[model samples]
Target: MHRLELDGITKQYPAVRANDGVSLRVKPGEIHAVLGENGAGKSTLMKVIYGAVQPDAGTIRWNGSPVTVRSPAEARALGISMVYQHFSLFDTLTAAENVWLGLDKAMKLPEVTRRITEVAHTYGLDVDPQRPVHTLSVGERQRVEIVRALLTDPQLLILDEPTSVLTPQAVDKLFVTLRQLAERGTSILYISHKLDEIRSLCHHCTVLRGGKVTGEVDPTQESNASLSRLMIGAEPPQLQHGTRPAGDVVLAVKGLSLAREDQFGVDLKDIGFDVRAGEIVGVAGVSGNGQQELMAALSGEDTRSPAGSIRLFGRDIAHHGARKRRHEGLHFVPEERLGRGAVPTLSLAQNTLLTRTEAVSRAGWIPSGRVTALADTIIRRFNVKAGGPGAAAKSLSGGNLQKFIVGREIDADPKLLVVSQPTWGVDVGAAALIRGELLKLRDAGCALLVVSEELDELFEISDRLIVIAQGRVSPSIPVAEATIEKIGEWMSGLWAPRETA
Candidate 1:
């Protein structure tokens, strides 16, 4: 008998039919993958099954019996649990506290802590249960979500874009955990745009396109091109990389140091780097290793640095605000898309006010037409899938939102661009496109600083690389000289000290 099943599922929002006649079945001890492009209805279907959204038409079966999951709690009670793509975590709470809130059992705080640590170790997630969720990195917080789901001991597990924030090593560890869970009779429904991961880890695959099921097959038996065709109805564009010439220094930092703003935050010490015009400098580190703090300082979100610490085109702007820095020919694309990069409640055209105020405003009043025109340009340039410029930012998928954000900054023609996690949560093809755009920007005489956990991405586009560990920047090296082993060592603060003359 199938462990979990969905038949004739259909979901309708005011503007779109998110899912149409979607059906899926997962046998016991199987890992089933749902593959699709951004905004292809994968998330909507999963939300319907998890009771986060009510399907307009469909029947759900668990263990061969029709059931109605009216709420997430009801789904949990029915031995079904889902880990959402966008995390639902309280930043102020400890890991144990966050898990305890989702759990049904009447366990004490101490017991919850014990259980969290035990499960973390068992699954090789290695999270600190006592650590505050606010202090954790994106990858660590993702582990918390996974551990929370595992503690439920559910008969079926649904993971949505689970590895989007994880490092390559962490992804391998998660696959091991999932394989173990499947061996113990736990069925998994994995949703992701990463075709290689789906093919390697999943036994079965279902592809969706325009809110409809287009194909179902064994993932291991299908090529990447075949799967892309099923999901997008066409082949994704190829990403090409070429050697770009370098120019004069556009951004330079020397002896940059700052104390922690928060009581528990990491302090940056003696950080230094430089990026030349027409070159890309990539900063690589494991999540939580000062990347956030560094990005903030560079982006002018946290401009507490002393005078002369940071220089843009030989000008001291250590105390400048974000807007001032932007006016000084510096642009930034933040990591968090919803609340940081773009406001969730605002329409895409209105959200342009967040960064492109001058472009969309005249005589101190916002021009709706200019804003719409700019947003339309972003959509066309980045190939963002949305209803139109009037659509809410939250209506778009993570990948599409990322493209929009990056494209917005790149279109401004800044002298220096600092982007964090340029393609996080993007599909392979989209990721390639974004990287290619960054390289093109570099080739066009724009200095770029890219901070990402993806080693492959950094190595591919960066002319120079630096590893940030515990809020300190390591020595920078040319891409030709940097190796994965050496960079990984730097991530852990294990590199040799500078030699004395």
Candidate 2:
């Protein structure tokens, strides 16, 4: 008998039919995957099963019996737990505190900490229990979410884009944990856009598109091409990759060191690197190892560095604010898309003003028309799916918003572009387009500094690579010479930091 089942589920939002008659079933101890492109109703259906969103019409079954899950608490009580794509963690709370809050059973703080430690060690999810959520990196934050859901001790678990921010090693560890859970009679509902992951980790797959299930198959026996056809109805785009020689240094960091802004954060120690025009430089690391701190320093979000620490085209702009950095042709696309890269409450056109200022009046007034025109251009050129220029940034799906923020920055034609997780939750086509655009910029003699946890992506476009671990960077190496084994070792801080210019 199926452990969990959804029949004829439908959910409607103000502007979109998020889910329509979506049906799926998960057997006991099975790892089932839901695959689709962005805004294709996968997340919505997961939310429905989790009881975070009420379905307009549907019947859910738990253990062969009909049920109505009205809230997350109710779902949890009925042996269901979920880890959302966008984490629902409190920034000020510690990792253990966050997990304790989610769990239903009463337990002391020390006991919860012990359990967290045990689970983390067993699953290869290393996280400090006392660290605040705000101080953790994107991948670390994801670990917190996973640990929290695991502590719930549910019979059915749903994970949405769980590995989006994980390193390759971390992803492999997660697969092991999921398989173990399934072997112990815990059913898992995995939702991700990564076909390779589903093929390797899931026992069954259900494809969603336009708020409906388009296809279902045993992903293990299916090819990537067949899955792509069922999900997006087309082949994925190919990247035009070619060699681009490094030019004069566009962004240089020397003796860059800074204390953590928060108590739980890692302090950067003598971080130094340089990216040149016509080349892509990639930073690889396990998350929470000062990736956020380093990005903050380079993006001008944290201006604690000395005047001579960071040089943009040989100019001392280390202490400049974000606006000053952008004005100097140093554009940044932050890792967090919702509030940092783009404002959630503002329309896409209005959000463009965060970095673009040419449409601004001399006295600090913004012409909405110019902003709209710019947004329209990005939407057209990048194939961003949105409800025109007036759509609120939060209204779009994660991938679409990612495309917009990336397209916005790329359209500006900056001399130095610092982007983190450039294609976090994007579909195959969108990811290819974004990478192609970055390469185009490189071919046009522009410098790009990319910070990503996905080693494949780094190897694909980066001309040189550096690894960050425990707040320090290893010696830079040519991409042609870097191997996955060596980079994985460096991710553990096993490699010593070396000077580079």
Candidate 3:
């Protein structure tokens, strides 16, 4: 009997038909992949399976028995556990407290905390049970979600973009854990746009396009190109990362040391780097290291750095706030999309005001018509899929929302752009689009500081690369001379002794 089966699942929304007559099947001990572009209905289908959303039409069978899973609690009772792309964690709650809410009420909080540690250690996931969700970085929060789901000991696990925020080393560790679970007869429904990962990790693959299944194949026998064709109907556009002589340094950090703001935060220690005009500088590291702290310091979110530590064009701007830096043509796209990059409840037009003020009058009154026009231009330019300018930021899919946030910043045409995880959770096509745009910006003599965990992305777009580990920055290396092996080693703070310029 199949471990799980779905037939003719159809979900209709006012703006789009998210799922249309989609059928899927999974066997026990199988690792099945669901492949699609952004808004291709992969996440929506997963939600239907997890009971987070009710399908307008579908028949679900569990172990040869038809059943209706009305809620997440009911899904968990039926041995189905899901780790969403956008985490379902509460910011005010500690890791253990959030995990405990999804588990049996009879279990004590201390017991849940202990189990979290055990699971984390066993799977090589670094998680702090006592850390509040607000204090955790995107990558660290990913670990907490994984550990929580593993504790459920479910028969079926639905992971949506689980490795999006993880470092290369962390991804390897997670694969081992998933393989072990599959061997123990747990079925996994993995949803990701990463073709290489699906080809290597999944046994079977289901490709989705336009809210329907396009093909099903044994992923082990498929190539990345074949998978891309299945998902997006064509190959992703190749990025042109041609290099030119760099101009004057646009952003320079020297001896940037800052104490952690909270007990759970990582302290920045003597971090230094330089980003020059007409170039892209990529920062690679494991999450929870100092990337968060470094970004805060550079973006002027934290003005606690010592004088002469940070300079833009040789000017002391270490004490400048985000707005002051923005006035000097420095714009940033934060790693956290919904809460930081864009507000959740605000319309797309309103969210534009977070980093833009061109539509505001001298009296500080925002002109709605101008704001909507700007938002519309960004949407059309970046090809963001949404319900026009009035759609709430949270209403769009993760990838679509990412495109909008990135588009919002790129539209500003800043002299220096600091973007963290520019294409996190986005589709292959969208990733290529965003990377190409960044390259265009670089070629136009705009300096860019890109922070991402994806080594492939860094190698594709960056001119120079640096690694961060344990709150310290490594010496810079040209992208032409950098190798995955060397960069991976550097990510662990294993670089040879050298002074960073």
Candidate 4:
């Protein structure tokens, strides 16, 4: 019997049809994949099912009976729970506290903490119950979300880009947990842009495009290319590798060490690396293993480092602020796109003025025309599908916002660029385009430092790679000489320097 069913789901927004006559069903013990590009209606449809959004027209059947899921509480009460792509966590609250607030049950703080620990242990999603949400790394925060969803013991669970922030080991653990859940008669609605993951984990898939269902197939029976064709109507262009040699070192970090700012945050040890002009250096690591700390030091978000630790063209810049660094032709694209990268409440046009002051008046006022023109250029050039330049940053889908931010920085023609998770939550087409753009920037003599969890992405665009483990960095090695096994081993802090060898 179908565990959940939707028919004729139509959600109409003022600027777009988020979901247009979409329909799908899930069976008990089924691990169903909802496959689509960004803004392709998969999220909207999932929201409709979970009661986060109300469809203008649709019939939702629960266990063979029609029902109206009026709110998240109602959905949860009906044995449904969801984990969002962008976390909805309270920065001020601890992990246990956040999870406690989500549930309808009343439990003592200690009891809730104990339950959290139990769930984390059971599911292999390690989380600290006492760590404040803001203090947690992106991957840890993701674990909080997953653990919370699992705690509900819902018959039907909805996971949106669930593994985006997790390490390979953590992802494997999650897959095992998901498989176990499926075997226990709990159905899963998995939403992700990782096609390989879907093929491996999902038994069935529903493809969507432009707010409509396009096809249904058993992903295990289909190839990646076939799935891409179904979802995007064309094969994504492969990013071409470069043949250029690296130039003089544009960015160098030597003996970079800093105490953890937050009580639960990771401390940077004697970290070191270098990025040369005309080459992309990829930093590989588990999420919490000092990437955030390192990004902060590099981007001038946290400048508590020694003056000589970070050098931009042989000049100490640890004292410079983020804007000052940007002024020096150093640009950064943060991993957290919503708040850190783009203000949600601001219009796209206004956000353009955030980094590019040229979009403002001579007196520093936001010039509407110039801002709009700049935003439009970025949108059009990046192939970002959004309402318009005047649309709020929160209005566009996650991928569109990412595209705009990346395009904004790339358009500036920076001498050095530091980007973290450049393709998180982005579709295959957008990822390919973005990766291609990064390579193109490198060819233009831009020194690029990339920090990513996807090993394939690192191999694709990087000329050299360094593994960061437990706040310490391994020696940089040429990409051609790097192996997944070597990088994977070094991710645990086991690496030897070439000079030492």
Candidate 5:
């Protein structure tokens, strides 16, 4: 029997038809990939299947019988579970507690913890069930979501952008886990914009573009170029990297250390780095290894460092606030887009007000026209898809939101730029465009610091690299000298200071 199927699915929003007559089928024990570009409606279709959103028109068939899925609880009861790209777990809860909350079957807290550990070990997920969700790395948190899904033993499993934050090694481990799940007769529906991953791991691929099905193919028989063409109607642009000449130091951090704010927080220890004008310095580590703390410190969100710790153009600014740093020609794009980087409830034009006062104001008076014009320029320059500047920040897709956030900072023309996970959850085309913009900025003499978990991205764009592990930063090395094995070892907190240097 077919494990899961959707026929003639359709959904509509105020501005667009999100999904139009979408149909898909997954056989038992098969890994099916849903491919699309940003705002292509892949997420909408999956949400319909998972009962997060009701379809305007459609039929869902499970085990060859038509059925109605009215809510997430209903879908879960029908042996379906989904792991979203954006996590839904509470930050303060333990992994076991989060998992227990999702489950329908009643069980003791100790029993739930035991099962979480057992399943994690069996699948090579390697998460500590007792660890608070806030304390776990991004990859470990993802494992908790996966383990929660596994506990349900769902007949159909759906995963959305599952590896965006994972390191290369973690991605491999996740693949093994998914393959094992598929072999055990659980049908899988995978959604991602990474064409290569889909081509390598999925048995069948369904392409979506602008809320419509573009094509379907056996991925094993298709090339990446062909799949890209099917999904986006064109090939993604290529990114070029070279050894750029460095200028004077623009941003420098020396002997920066901080005590943990929270009881479980990671205390930064002896972190030192420098970004020269016309240079890009990449800091790489698995998430939760002090990337958050470092970004906070660099962005002026946590300005409790000692005097002379952080310097901009040879001037100490350790006590400056975020607005003061921005006024001093420093710009930042944080990792979280929804609330931290951009406000969700605000319109795109209004969001620009968060940091673009100079661009849209004169002597403390807000110029409404200039604000709209600035937002319009950013939208056009970044190719952001939205309902003009009036659209709320939450209305855009993940990739589009990321583009807007990055573009907002880039347009400010700062002397120094600090960005974290610049392309997290973005599609390939958007990712390439964002990287191209960063390179252009670097060439234009803007110093840049990029903190990300993706090694390939760092190696491709960084002039120098550093590893952050357990709240400590390694000495910087040239990109040529940073090996994948060495970086992976550093991720585990194994590298000594001498080895890093």
Candidate 6:
């Protein structure tokens, strides 16, 4: 008997039919991949299977028996566990506390904490159980979620964009853990936009498009091009990266040092770099190694740096606020999409006010029509799949929200742009789009500082690369002279004496 089966699953929303007559089957010890673009019904179908959302029409069978899972708790009771794309964790709760809530009541908190440590060590995921969810970086929080689900020992495990924020090394470790679980007879339903990952890690693949299943095949036998065609109906557009001499420095940071805001946070120590006009500089690092603190300092969120530390166009803006800095033409795209990038409950058009003030008059009155028109332009330009500008930021898929947030800042035409994880959860096509837009900005004499854990992305677009490790910055190297092996070494805080000289 198959481990899990779904037939004719259909879900309808006010503005879109999220899933339409979708069907899937997973066998014992199978690692099945669900491949699709943003808003292609992959997440909706997964939610239906995990009982977070009830399908309008469908029949679900578990081990040859028909079942009705009415809630997430019921799904867990039936051996189904899901790690959502947007985390379900509470900000105030510690990692162990959050994990304990999902487990049986009979288990004690201390026992849960101990098991968390054991599982984390065994899987090499490196999760700290006592830290609050709000204190963790995106990648660190991802580790906690994965550990919590692994502790359940469920028959069916569903992971949604699990490695979207993780480093390449961490991704390899996670794949090892997943392979072990599958070998032990756990059926895993994996969802990711990374074509290469699906082709290598998954046994079977199911492709979805326009809320319907388009094809199913053995992923090992398929090429990346074939999988991309199946998911988006075409190959992703190629990015054009031309060489150009960098102009005068637009952003100069020197002797930037700040203490940790909380006990769980990393301190920024003597962080310094320069972003020049017509050049793209990339910052590569592991999560929680002070990237957040550095970004906060650079973006004016944390104005604790000393005077003369941060200079924009030769003006000292070390103590400037976000709004003041933004007014000076420094735009930012934060990594946390729902909370920092856009308010979860705010309409897309209304969220534009967070960064773009053109729709508002000098007297502080917002024009609704202009705001909606601006948002519509971004949506159309970026190809964001949503229920129009009226939809709440939380209503769209993770990738779609990312596109909107990134597009919002890019549309502002800033002299300097600071973006973090530009394509964290986006599909290949959308990733290409965002990258191309960044390159275009560079070609237009705009300075760009991109911070990402994806080395491949950094290598592809950056003219010069710098590594951040343990709250310190490494010497910059031209991308043409850099290799993955050298970058990997620098990520561990190792820099040669010659480079320092």
Best by lDDT: 3
Candidate 2 Cα outliers beyond 4 Å, as residue runs: 496-501
Q: Score candidate 1 by TM-score against the native.
A: 0.94
* Model 1 pairs whose backbones collide: none
Candidate 3 residue pairs that clash: none
Error of 4 at 295 (Å): 1.2
lDDT of 5 by residue, 332-393 (tens): 99888888888999999999999888865456777888899999999999999999999999
- Whole-model lDDT for model 4 versus the true structure? 0.89
Give the residue spans of candidate 5 off by over 4 A.
Answer: 124-141, 360-363
Quote the positional error of residue 396 for candidate 2 in Å. 0.9
Residue 396 CA error for candidate 5 (Å)? 1.0
What TM-score do all the candidates reach, one by one? 0.94, 0.97, 0.98, 0.97, 0.96, 0.97
Alpha carbon lDDT of residue 143, candidate 6? 79
User: Where is the poorest 10-residue window by lDDT in model 4?
Assistant: 492-501
| lDDT score of residue 26 within candidate 2 | 94
Give the Å shift of residue 366 in candidate 6: 1.8
Which segments of candidate 3 are over 4 A away from where they belong?
A: 499-501
lDDT of 6 by residue, 261-287 (tens): 999998888888899999999999888
Model 2, span 1-501: residue lDDT tens: 999889999999888899989999999999999988899998888888888888999899999999988888898899899998888999989999999887756788899999999988877887899988877777788888888889888899999878866667778888988999999999999987778899999999999989999999999999988898898898787777787567899999999999988787888999888899999999998788898889899988899998799999999999999889999999999889998889899999999888888878899877778889998998899888899999999999999999999999999999999999999878776787899999999999989999888788899889999999889998999988888988888888877545332
* Alpha carbon deviation, residue 406, candidate 6 (Å): 0.8
Candidate 3 on 325-365: residue-level lDDT in tens? 99999999999998899989999999999999877999999
**RMSDs, each prediction?**
2.3, 1.7, 1.3, 1.6, 1.8, 1.4
Sort by lDDT, best first: what order?
3, 6, 4, 2, 5, 1
Model 6: weakest 10-residue lDDT segment is 162-171
Better of 3 and 4 by TM-score: 3
